[model samples]
Target: MTGLAGIVAAETRLSMVDGENGRLIYQGYLAKDLALNYSFEEVAYLLLYGKLPSKTELHGFQCKLAENRHLPAYLIRILNELPEDMEVMSVLRTAISSLGRSEFGWKPNIDQAIRLIAITPVIVAYRYRQQHNLPIIKPSDNLNHTANYLYMLTGEVPKDVHIRALTVYMILTMEHGMNASTFAARVVTSTHSDLASAIVGAIGAMKGPLHGGAPTEVIQLLDEIGSLENAELYIRGKLERGELLMGFGHRVYKTTDPRAEALRSITSELIGEDAWLDLAYHVEKTAIQLLDEFKPGRRLYTNVEFYAAAVLKAVEMPAELFTPTFTVSRTVGWTAHVIEQADNNKIFRPQSEYVGEIPS
Candidate 1:
């Protein structure tokens, strides 16, 4: 059936994607409330461990993540050997495979999950630096996950605003029902596979443009529009010409994505009237108004990708690193799903309907 649309193939208590209501719930806390109140680490702990942590447990969890952030020398060498032209997602997947193989485990565990989540930023940082000829930076035990990732990328202590903003993004995106990558992860885990194999397969799924790669195209669209004056005509022209706007719609949310609403506040706080931010806001309004006029009854509201572009650009994140950065947060959800699947232990075996004429 059309990409398994409307089919409930599995069960979960991790996160809920309430598409009709345009709400995302991570373990009973509303996604927007989590973004506004909780740190990424707390939310990650909530997703995996099934509840928020105590102060001491939070400290211990932070220490575990900080302790694992440094990659082995050979992994760094792998980053160096990767060609500049190679897709970063492939390198990331293979590097994860290498990391997984180095550690021998057949079943899912918290340690495996922690290491995968912690080390992903390091992998992304080293490779991104190597490609740009920037100096590689080490992880700091002093910093939290978001700050540490920014420091590793920029080789400077990150600003508080950037860390806070990205922490919201991480929390909002950490888990959301059975997304493609999460499904891929659970499917692999159901076969009694290694943790790395499952994560590797998940990464391969996320690399597709229809899934994780949409935000970079949002960057391109915003750039092409360029100014507030250009927004209405530019958007209306694209609508009239039957071209799709990258950030205006989603397969899930029937109204404004809650994550988008959360990020709009972050973007406003960080951008503070920048020209591109202004233009993006205007484009959003004009696109919404025009979509109602042109295609009636289509919900077509602003989804997370729209404000994700704005928030990332406000933090000075390069367009190319967008999806890879997504991996850093999303790994938490994938690992949690793997553990859940391993606990339940069912091999996914869906039957395909045969339509071709059989030779009898």
Candidate 2:
């Protein structure tokens, strides 16, 4: 009976997502502050090693991350052959599954982790180009994770703020305790599966509308509303039908999501001068007011999806690539968690209540 939902053990190393206070903290530091003040390399070091890296350690880590940025030709060919009409997430899933078939597929060593981190941006960039019939841009050794991803995707270096926003988004989405995708990863790792398989499983879970698919829907809702004047009508109509606003609530966060605000300010900074900034701000204000006036006691504040979509939209990344880009950044966390689970190896079976009658 005690094993029904097997304890994943007293929470080991991780930042707390403080729902009530609207804060996300890594080793006790706030996420919004981290995104503003730290580089992605620094944040990645903190997540993987449980402490901030020294200057030399960070440089070395960044080098290793950059080293794996080059994808094998075979992988790129496979990606190019995928149907252009396929959804980008589908393409990512297929590509990772393909990697699972490679020689180093199931290895859990440092090499495997580096490879996953390095090539994720490549898969994302190549698929994006293939979808658009544009030439694939290669990764550069000089650039860090955030910079390289932007370069490969757009064939140019991003503005400092844009890069910083993306780096924050990556860190924010990196790891959360037992999120659907993270849980899926644990289940796969329980089988001593390869990194690619574990990632594929996580991607499958994230494909669900309740999880990774919300950002795309959030963007769609904004476009449908078209202007600030219609924000109230749009959100009210959706809520009246008993529909949950796409980016407003979380299953775990009882009060607010801290990552939302972190990304919210980033969205504003990135959208500087685009008229859409004003439109989105008005929408945010209207959404808050309506949620307060209507839902009264509910603490449905913005989650990461709200500003994530806005920020990415401001960067001109297509709506379809939101989740795929999410996958790329989050792959680091998935790999880190899988390694952690395998190091303390345990099967992740959970039993459900037997509600049905016994068979004769």
Candidate 3:
């Protein structure tokens, strides 16, 4: 099944990507609705625990996440010894693999999942701060998962709007149906390997540019456009020259991307508050109009990375951290898939077709 397109490899109760209708469902709830109304911890809990947590359950989960946010001394030392110029994703892959002790062995469990989810942002922020020679900011108990990540990166409490925007992005991106990284994670788990090992594999897959690097390109597009005045001209020139627009369309989403829809709503609400988001909202409208005019039957619309570039930029996230941030959110999805794979284990062994003649 060349690249496995149109093949149903396994069953999952996690997320369903309805490309036909441009809808995403997370365990029967619309992902857009969840992103608009729920917290990151709530959605992560939903994915990992198979349901939303009660008030007491949520407090306990939040406490557990806060407790596990600190990096081990050995891991910190490892981070210090690594080269400053190493890619952040490479650093993350190394740090996660370092956690594969005997306790993270076969038969993955929720405790192991929680630990990885909690510490991923710390690993990224630690390495990033060290690379820039900035002081490392420890995680704050007062902040929730989304806000703490922002705090660690900048050492200041983030604005409520920035936190809300980032939380929506995180929840919307937390899961999708069998994406490359998620598939990599599940394949490794199917080998009866530890959850950490499976996640390491997923991180490796995400490290590839094809999967996790779209946001960087989208950022470049936004930077080039620069302001609302230039959006139409810049986008029209690209379309006229038959150049690829970075965030206009998607392979699976035939219409608008639901994730993009939710993010656009948030960005639109903050129109006068953030220049980048305002620019993004305008640029998206211009680009879509130009897309329909230039490539009339293509039906190209803004994908998640379009507004992702805007939101992250509005919150002052550096360009280099884009994919790593994606990794941080996607860890929840990866761990959830790992747990599901363990429940009904099967090694992923697909047959490859050969065109050459066989020996008789």
Candidate 4:
């Protein structure tokens, strides 16, 4: 039972991670398809409500999300008071924890889920702008979820290309099968805890490097390689030295990550628009070839974090905001799991084996 590696903890109607086959499904739709064709709000609605929303329903949902995007004055004041030296993730965890008031208590519902999902990006943007001494941008009623997030961060209406790229990233990452953060959310919800409390726990788990830090590392790897010409040499040197290529493999996917494939397809269409993405496409090709030559039978391929780094960088997202952006997308999944866990509640109490023996 170490790390519960093979244990099936709980049943969920959310996204399915088919690592053996390199597919991800949300409710019933292919996550790749959803990312390629749907809006962030649409896919998020699907995860939270168990189906895609009709036009009217989507409009209402969009308005509800937009309406809730503003932070309370008290939360803003609290964000201002936090130390500048604190990690953004720590600030995010603390800001989210502060929302665990009476209204967010047991039996979490869609309204609460919507509120949490809508406000997470705002919280991150607020803290980010505050740290940089930039004026906080209010959420735009006209823009969709993904667009508004970029707008809030940059104080400009993002280009359609950037929005499309980031929307695909967000939709694809909105959920996966039970990972660390989702498990933490469910574990808290099993106690009939508030949604905010569960989300706070989830954010704490996501702050861990093993869980949410890959995209930043991938960015670093891309930066070091710097160009298509260096791709082969940089990657070959790393492999020759027995260093792990940050974005080329995944623990879950034995084959190519479907999310990565989908992102590659989208970024390919906009190839010359962003150099980082163009370089990523080249680098991935070179790395796969090098990986096969250097580590025979390893079956290493690009994971989602590979192109996630490219997309975020193309949109001018700072490296520090990488995991926090991931958090914003994953909040949809966390709240959905919280609601599901509340429906069929079970307090998690796994037994730990004791290896130490009494002195004889």
Q: Compare the candidates by lDDT and give the number of the best one.
A: 3
Per-residue lDDT of 274 in model 4: 79
Go through the candidates in order and give the C-alpha RMSD of each one to the true structure: 2.3, 3.4, 1.6, 1.7
Q: Show model 2 residue runs off by greater than 4 Å.
A: 1-10, 101-107, 225-246, 268-271, 353-359
lDDT of 2 by residue, 92-181 (tens): 889888888665455465567777877887888888887787887989998888888888989998877667767888878776666778
- Please give the TM-score that candidate 1 achieves against the real structure: 0.92
Q: Tens digits of per-residue lDDT for model 4 on 131-199?
A: 898998988888889899999999999999999999999988889889999999999988888999999
| Cα lDDT tens digits for candidate 1, 63-128 | 999999988889878777877887678889989999767463788888899999999988888888
Worst 10 contiguous positions by lDDT, candidate 1:
267-276
- Model 3, span 1-360: residue lDDT tens: 368988898899999999999999998899999999899999999999889989999999999999999999999999999987898999999999999999798799999999999999999998889899899999998899999999999999999989999999999889988989999999999989999999999999999998987487888898999989999999889988989999889989999999999999998888898888989999999888888888899889999988888899989999889889999999999999999999998899988889899999
lDDT for model 1, please. 0.86
* Worst window of 10 by summed lDDT in candidate 2: 3-12
Off by over 4 Å in 3: 355-360
* Per-residue error (Å), model 2, residue 12: 2.8
Model 2 per-residue lDDT at 67 = 81
Candidate 3: TM-score? 0.96
Best by TM-score: 3
Q: For model 3, what is the error of residue 32's alpha carbon versus the real structure, in angstroms, after optimal superposition?
A: 0.9
lDDT at position 75, candidate 1: 86
Ranking the candidates on TM-score from highest down gives 3, 4, 1, 2
